[model samples]
Target: MIKITYKMKSYRENLKDIIQPDDTIIELGCHVGKSSQFMLNRIPNGNLIALDNSPEAKSKMDKLSFEYKNLSFLNSDVRLHESLKKVKEKIDKCDILSVDLGGGYHPDTTFKVYYIWSSTFKPRDSIIRNRGLIDFINTATSNEDMHSENGFLDSCGDMGIPPQIKEFKLWSEKI
Candidate 1:
């Protein structure tokens, strides 16, 4: 298992650039609140909604919540459409949607969950695990005809993501 310190270091080095002070952030798969805590430190005036299905994850975040008043934990399976809908209704808009569902989830399921949760918010930056899903989405959304034979690109194309969505990398390196 990857230690939480490594995850926190990865976020600090690679993903910290995208976050702003007052941005409303929603993190999917807050395992042990490690990543959430990293994001919390940056968002002083901002609020975070951390979601995870594991009871242990919830318990860990519950303990950390006392230290950070702006952080909130929601114990729910982010892959579920109902849970995504409920979360979308609660937040007016999300500035950043950080997704790290861990290695248990297949890349396709991760992309599907990201797509579902992303639709609720208007054009915002996102940091996703560099599990080929980001590369696939970037290639699919761009007009450049690269990686045509890639399986992930084919899958995103099948999902009907238009070529108009802007493509950018939020993290410099994979965590």
Candidate 2:
């Protein structure tokens, strides 16, 4: 099965740059730890906590955790503030917080109504949505292009998402 997720680009503030070896990294929707591995490289001595509430996802995380001594897995929902707060205490400030809420979205929201789910095309068989959420502070609009065959880009970016977030991107100045 193909997935349609928020796309994230590595930047200055990204885990690879900002997170020191001693710094702890927190990532949401870690899934199978695809990008998690990238962040791990930046922190040699640090521990990475991948947050995902799904049992299958968590089990996947468990499998990955054994490989990396510096890696830890957590099975908890995003809305579970109690658990998240506990994590926050250990890691005071986040050098990078990956907001990737892709898996387990119940297929689609109101936006999916407009999305073409099924047709002469075979949906995921025909197309795959590769998106990674990025940081867009104090913004009301952003621009992005949909897939080649698909130009209809209904981005959540407009609802306060970043245009492009990659390779050491940073915004210390208050919006």
Candidate 3:
């Protein structure tokens, strides 16, 4: 799986460059079928398994499945064991794993999904679009900087910190 350590502007922003014509893809959090269609167009012979928990997303995907024979939709949540088990029964393996849950807002959830799915499929490559994770990597500093007199708030950059969070120590201490 490919690990991206920098900030990406959009979800799976660089996927077009990596996807091959015959690469099987499993896309988690396919909101509608925009990205799914793009991937289908790329892989004429390959297959795509698009998974989403939303009823709205499922309705759209159900329609798309009719139009594309190679496309399949699974209404399942990546975070749930039962849901994932159902999804696993449908697909054995894939060449690429693409994930963009919650529009890539929650890094923790994104990491969890990536961990579970990567372990299940063991894809040749993976692309995860999470702003929080990218920002965390971009803003990380050295241990010496973290131990500065000003502390974590002053030492680390502020790219990923949400406005709702007032204090880093308080948030970190919670969990």
Candidate 4:
């Protein structure tokens, strides 16, 4: 399951569909450990490696780490290649990858980050929440009448295709 959305109403909504009990998860941008804690609660036999650059976020997650043996916090910026290498060295496998960079208002950066991390870990499942991505889709598909009749698009539903879908499909296969 790969979910790319404007925003998740709640991160926990579809967690069961993406994770298993013994799955190893790598979560990027786990701010204050709210969703981190939620994922931790769901994975008792598994482990969660959460990365965030914010010291305050790490401070909070440190407390959760103390309480949940399966949870570990890494203080590293996800946008840096060095950080990716650091994470790669620590984990042998990543079963699921969850990313929510907060204030995701830049589609190019979001897509680049998502692509790098997804390609690196090659997680079986990935969930990314970025408003800019949805905005980009809307703008690119506007002239094609891709918007819904209600004038709103739901990322989870069938929101029509972008002009580049044909080329994207072909390019994706090479990977």
Which is the leading candidate under lDDT?
A: 4
lDDT of each: 0.65, 0.46, 0.69, 0.71
Q: lDDT tens digits, residues 1-175, model 2?
A: 1223333453223334445676565665676777777777777887777777766686667877887888877787644434455565555444334445552334332123212211101221111222211112222365854442322233332232132321112111211
Q: For each candidate, what TM-score against the reference?
A: 0.69, 0.50, 0.73, 0.75
Model 2, position 40: C-alpha lDDT score: 79
Q: How many Å off is the CA of 9 in candidate 2?
A: 5.7
Per-residue C-alpha lDDT of model 3 across residues 1-175, encoded as one tens digit per residue: 3645334344445677778888888888898888898889989989998889887898889999999999988887766666556666777677888887755555977866665566566677777777788788788877653332221223233333232333211122211
- Estimate, for each residue in 1-120, the C-alpha lDDT of model 1 and write its tens digit: 011112445655555777789988888888898879889999999989999998789779998888999988888888654566667668757877777787342467666656555555
Rate residue 143 of model 1 by lDDT.
62
How well is each residue in 13-80 modelled by candidate 4, as lDDT tens digits? Answer: 75656778888999988999988888887888999999899868977988989999998788888776
Model 3 bad stretches (over 4 Å): 1-13, 142-175
Ranking by TM-score: 4, 3, 1, 2
Better of 2 and 3 by TM-score: 3
Whole-structure CA lDDT of model 1: 0.65
Candidate 4, pairs of clashing residues? none
Those runs of model 2 whose alpha carbons end farther than 4 Å from true positions after fitting are 1-17, 103-175
TM-score of 4: 0.75
TM-score of 3: 0.73
Give the Å error, residue 152, model 2.
31
Candidate 1 vs 3: which has more lDDT: 3
RMSD of each: 9.9, 14.0, 10.5, 8.5
